[model samples]
Target: MRRGAICAAGLLVALLLPAPAPAREAEPRRAPEPNTLVPAGAVRYAPSGFPDRIVATPAEDPSSGFAVAWRTGATVDTPWLEIVEAGDSPDMGAPRRIRATTRALTTENGAAHHHRADVAGLEADTLYAWRVQGGGTWSPWRQLRTAAAADAPLTLLYFGDTQNKNASLTTRVSLEALRHAPDARLALYAGDLVSGGDGEDDDEWGEWFDATAALRSLLMVAPAAGNHEHFEQFEDTPRERRVLGAHWPATFALPGNGAPGAEQTTWWFDFQDVRVVVLDGTSALDMGTARAQAAWLDGVLAGAASRWTIALIHQPMFSPRQDRDNALLREHLLPVLERRRVDLVLQGHDHVYGRRGGLRAGQATPQYVVSVAGAKQYRLSDAARDTMAPVAEDTQLFQVLRIDGDALHYEARTATGRLYDAFSLHRAAGGARRIEEHTGDRIGQRDCPRAATLKGRTDRCWE
Candidate 1:
């Protein structure tokens, strides 16, 4: 059976299985086999590196400022940036090195080391080489293209979810996205980065990061927290509030523009012409921070100056899944987005792909997207048409967006890079909006077709 089928089956098993025995361990204790590959020959030229969760450097203007964050197994008290502009000629001489370090952070997930070095003092709209290094060996030099000075034209990659078996199949999707857009300015992850929360023992995060090393070399990652990142109740508090034990905050340097309590991951950043807002859907709905985040979000929207606005988070305020529409968030967030004329709202949680339109206050259409990027799969409801433009069930997918002038082109490509759906949102000089959807190769009404059965798998949800 196909991997998706197996995943579907596994999920079904979980639902069908008897309640867990009282002896079940609170934390799973499976350690992945160590990876010991020495870079040699052609391997030395590969983009893969030692540090896991390797992510790109993001600057206010990507062409001018460049920053990157990486994690190491051991402590690196001091970390720095080694960067230089590569000339047209091969002999670009040596790079100029700048040093910096992060306050050491050790979590229950693992011994963690993180550093963010912003390389300034450079030309605009240029390609530069850079990497991160600590006390030990410096990372292999990687290339990055800086952002344009102002209103620069660029392409940004957006993905739905990569929250499954990180080691085997999830990597393929992430690697494929990087391969498709090696020079993409930045990447937006719409949450569900891992399958579990503070119980950091879940191996999916490690696997997801391990597979996206090459793409991480030049991409800045902006991730939102999905429901899957939530953990069950622990002690008197929930796991989501318990430091979020995984490498969440340390893995990425997100803008801290959220409410008082949830500041690190929930923030907004401007990429020249676009204002990107990230929210913690988990916190909004379950953490009692909805009122706070919603209040702050309204303020941010009211004061925004960017020409275009985009918000990314985990749960879909609108989904094709039955009873999955986040009414609370919709009540709080949708009005602000509509009032702000938000261009795009990217989200993932329903494990399906959908794009709805004709959005208004009470009876809204599917103008937002809910996608899945892992081995997991879910079924779409027939009523999805009420809220979803096009829904894809039981398929792993990613979205690539290209911004050129007033036209924002969006293509929802599957894991295999198939342009399953395409559309363009044109922002006219008159401040009017026009949406065009292409139906030539459209994958009709998504449903989980009869899939081959995985022999020994206990999960059947994906099938």
Candidate 2:
């Protein structure tokens, strides 16, 4: 047969064949079971003869000294820390050993002891290497720099809640923030570092420590207390009482100079040109310590000697979530903050990002910011959406603040190290403060589909 005729006959016969059926849709995967205990193959973070969760915190006067705290097994009855001034040579010259103040702490996992050592009388702006000894074993030497005695330029890293998914999600943001500001003198956490606040959830605390291990060891930590840091006294009690979690006291060695009743959670310290005042917002709201805290706050700010004052509280002055409002805080603490003219206020607990300039017109002294650095996110309230500029939802954020003489620069960056918002506050010797917003070529605000508007609702807002 001819080639063309043969080909045409074969094509016509093939065209008559039946089409193949579509592949069956894959079955939907079942959700995994929820487990509160440490996952398999994960580090248990059980206390041992060696020190772990070693954290460095600012002393009442950071220029003069700093404090270090660590966790050890109960078997280590007498723990101590050794310190030496860092020099060019490798050998540490004649280290000084200081006895640690050890406190017995019992968690769900096991009994442990937390040891704190105050390394005092150190030279200002000097580098020092220190390590902790539990029993006969010692921790690796870690280096830290003391704050300058004078009003020198400084950098600070501010973080919001790392409450949920610390090891898996929040760790990246925390590490990236440190990489972005390698010279930061202090890291101020707004609060709710761990999800479980009952103080018995050692695993959650382990995750938090894992996320900021390097930060705690390298720089000073100033943490505020959030509502999650408070545990209910009795379940379903009519008088619903809350108390500060036990872990808070054992986790960090903060300055003792705070409000009379809430010393551990409320404290202040001076680092170079700025004064950081950490308030126990949870205590004030739940434990009836608002009036006392307010009085203490006013007194603390009244005698402020630093050129700048920054306040850290867990609850937002201006809430970003519609369902939440801190009327008690606004009533008791807002006045003190305004009257004291706090330069900056960093807060958390709404699971969203918000920044509001001063309430008064032509004034920029008190800038309010609420940010979240964890995976959990919330829907933005209408009021926040309308009033707050550069607000964000479903976004993890970290802030870097630099103070140089009369000018302070602030930058808020996302988890991926992208600048989301920025502003600069400058003051003239006796003149009013001025703020300039950096609104040029920044990333757009992030928002997820509203729950009410979605066709099929999921467990999370973003989903």
Candidate 3:
């Protein structure tokens, strides 16, 4: 009788209890494996199982998509990405999973692995929190915000060759770029991210990546391949020469709409209202590739319905350095730029600051610029002054390009935050564009302050 009473009480308790909620399905984790890569030498350059050198780059379409490339130790075979729409509250739901494509780059330096994920189908102007998984380990969630719709205002930070001494350099410029234009959405790196093509994996690249980690984490870089990006190992010839660096292709995955031979290296993509074309100047100039690129450029410019088109290249159409005239660029590329009425042209490799442009007959547009962002400085020649006004020397500068409807303001500032040069481009009737120069101290005279002693300092330029 007592047993029957106890069973009746249990049944009564069950009837009084609340209904159970469905449990959420948990995300799957990768199985762990032992890491065996050694640390003694550069060989098997798998530094760590954790991801390093993570960079977020713009896909062909910035408003809808973006890409992430990162390196990790070889132990993690199948790296993947977990991304979710970032929310204000901490109780966000499970993220969507996207698999990564792995490229095994085996260099004499070591065996390094590069993994890239092109995230698409994203909402415009939405913030996302994403993290990568290297085997069982996971990186901290990093946040990225997609670009706004087609008609939004565009702002970009422009910089020149950050080639050699990069690890010790470039970061300051990157910070300065943010300091000047914090709302800057992207950076135009005029190629030569490293000094030499040491191998698939090298120290210079490590330094370059590490130093720029802070800025690249926030901004997507549109990089072109400068001369230093190419290197070749010729067993047949005793003389050693550099060809396109091995890391160039793997490191940067730009848009694939460039010339015939130059694919990602020379490409064009439109963000907001601006169309940015990054050309492979080194390949086009020396390797008889200019014609194809010019043809490709014409098509790109013709098809681009954007309000503004800007061309970015490593070699200058109008050379700042006396010895460095890009005749091929002038003959092949200049006509297309002029015909397309491109608003601005950004170039590097002269290691000096120069700009030349004005309203010309029949509406020839596109102002030319060559600037240096690193500590390496070159002298401004007298002949360049005829074409370029307010030419600067021994200066490291960062340029901010702001594009709004009907007007674009361009400002070039020194590393120490001095306005070195400024100009404005106004879109006129039909398709013609006009330039309005910004007036300031004009330009400080480039007088070589000769070996005058300054406050116990020997052999310095007297300001």
Q: Write the per-residue lDDT of candidate 2 for residues 1-463, one digit (tens) a residue.
A: 9999999999998888876789999998554322234675455888989899899999989888888889999988667899999888889798999999988988876899999898899999999989999867999988899998656889999999988777777889988998899999899999998878544478888878888887877898888888777788776878777888788888888888999788879999888988888998888887888999999999999888888899999999899886889899999999999888898999999888998876787678799999999877777899999888889988899999999988899999999999998999888777467889898957998887656323244434531
> Compared with the true structure, what per-residue lDDT tens digits does model 1 show for residues 1-463?
9999999999999999898668755776445322212212212112122444556645544446755667664556556777888677767878888775564455444455676665677787678877677446677777777667456677888888777665566677887787777657778888877676433432445556776666676666777877776554465654424335445666666545566667865887677677788888778777777778878887877777766778888887776775566888888877777776777889888877887764655322225778888777766766785656677777888778888778787888788887777888877776667777788976656567635324323223362
Index of the highest-TM-score prediction: 2
In angstroms, give how far residue 171 of model 3 lies from its true place: 1.8
Q: TM-scores for all candidates?
A: 0.80, 0.91, 0.83
Model 2: what TM-score? 0.91
Give per-residue CA lDDT, model 3, range 1-463, as digits (tens).
6999999999999999986888988878534221111234544334467787778878878878888888776666758998999888775689988888888776555677788888889988778888887757788887777887767787888888776555555667777778889888888888767666344336667767765776776777788889888765573598654467667767765657678988858887778888888898988977678999999999988999888889999998888775667888888889898877788889888777888873364343678899988645555556777778667766777899998888899998877777888888888777567778788744564533434322333222211
| Candidate 3 Cα RMSD (Å) | 21.7
| Candidate 2 stretches greater than 4 Å from native | 1-37, 40-43, 197-200, 238-240, 449-463
- Rank the candidate models, highest TM-score first: 2, 3, 1
Positional deviation of 144 in candidate 2, in angstroms? 0.2
Better of 1 and 3 by TM-score: 3
Count: clashes, candidate 3: 8
Clashes of each: 25, 0, 8
